[model samples]
Target: METLANLESFVRSADHGSFSEAARRLALTPAAVSRNVAMLERNLGVRLFHRSTRKLTLTEAGEAFRNAISGSLSDIQAAIAGAANGGGEPTGVLKVSLAPTFGTMHILPLLPAFIARYRGVRPEWHFENRQVDIIAEGYDAAIGGGFDLSPGVVARTLAPAHIIAVSSPAYLAGRKLPAGPADLAELDGIVMRSLQSGRIRHWTMRDAAGEQIPAPLREVFVFNDPAAMRRSALLGLGVAMLAVPDVIDDLESGALIRVAPRWYADAGAISIYFASRTLLPGKTRAFIDYIVDAFKQRRLAERFAGSLG
Candidate 1:
């Protein structure tokens, strides 16, 4: 394999017009520079520089190779330094921004366990319901849901958001249960209006053919909070599209019934994202692993399954 050190030697030798001079500049012997350049040329099976007794000049191939190698060498050097610092123990404060419902219900329950595992890093978390600029807000990491992340961010999937329509059996007992997605129009429902938007959040569903279709829901009561809508649905008010965890208790206790399978689409996975330009500290990487590990080891899988049913 060709070494980056050989490419560096060749680049230096061409610039200074002599192997001896380049070696002197790089604190190496002339023979070392010659071996590096020779090995590089042998590896590529092409001459990089035309050599003579009087002067040195680049072959057409030499100029092209130098241009490619120069930029890559700079990047390699920078990556090495960054990896060393970024992969080591993180000492400074790590700032994270996460969604409110996810932060409160999912991530917050996960923090203490991670904190207990790694003692070297301290995290400062900011939770908000409204969307904000991650860079402008100075957050190093962010947890986002079904929303599309900005072009400048690097995203990784954490878990999925499976929003389902559920209602109390008391509410559906005498009433006709919607057999199809369109039938939701005939049922009384508690709709969640997005606080960001003035309109109510519609119940969307899919079929075995993978067609995603939105079902028009007649809103008997509109609420901004899913938790509140879940509360209303529990009292036998109406069916509501709620996050799985929000209704896991009621579903397990046989208090709520899953409604209209046609409206339940493929799972929409929630993601954890970070600024692309920023290098993640070791602690940040570790925390991501730690959270994923806890998700598996803990009964999160069982709970999610029970909730989904």
Candidate 2:
């Protein structure tokens, strides 16, 4: 029989592709995790990982074994947590992944109230720009847009990720304001380059009247991150197509103004993602409920809609 620690070490190591990260999550040393995995491999009589200096990859047996035990391990952990927390109270570290600017501006404000309400739940948040593997990486939840719904994961949409062209008032001072999406081509563009593919993103703007037009702003500046693009737009660099949620505050504060106000692009929905398990952890449930309630109270979906522009 395999010990729970060995199984946990193996699964986490596989999820993160490194023992150091697994050790950090487990609060064990890398050497300890490595030894636990070694012990498990010896008992199983098969090597699970193809260990290399740069990467740790799962063998065929390792992948199959991990798939077999990962869900069971999660369930066992959740059961243990439930029993320890008196079966109801939301307790333990609620690890979540979030986008940097959006999380800081929008979600972080709700923390005080959340902590006050659920005193036992501690938030462990990672502000990142990329989509994370919720189950594999052991994240309680993730908040972002355009995530592929992998098996055993589910998403609840919080807001429309409507993209709209924006520019600083200073940048538009001497330029002819765009009358429509087509006119946007005359202005200098602060465009986004996809970090994943290294390709420039092009958008088609839609009006409230259901009219669509190609948005081809002359590319003057390019960035990989929306926050960086927002900063550049603020510096009077050029017009940028940014997610409404990311620039709502700036728009409200008059730091950034919508270009071709009648038109916008539909990016997708900003969603909260979590593992789809039969029994969710109390902390995870509480966090999800709190965030959903917050979005409702704030009417973020309506506010984030670009059609309103």
Q: Model-by-model lDDT, in order?
A: 0.72, 0.93
lDDT of 2 at 186: 91
Give lDDT tens digits, candidate 1, residues 1-309. 779779878877876778988888678998999899989999999999999988878899999998677656645644664576665554445678877766777788877767776666688998876665654344667775665576455677665566778888988988887886777778787898887878887756776566666777788888987778888998988778776766766777988878874456445666677655434456666766676677778756556532244
Best by the lDDT measure: 2
Candidate 2 per-residue lDDT over residues 1-309, each given as its tens digit = 899899999998998999999999899999999999999999999999999999999999999999998788878877777888887679899999999999999999999999999999989999998988888777999998999999779999999999999999999998899899999989899998997889999999999989999999887998899999999999999899999989999999999999999899998899999998767899999999999999999999999999998
Show where candidate 1 strays beyond 4 Å: 1-88, 211-213, 296-309
Q: Candidate 2: global Cα-lDDT?
A: 0.93
TM-score to native of every candidate shown:
0.64, 0.85
- Residue pairs clashing in model 2 are none
Error of 2 at 269 (Å): 1.1
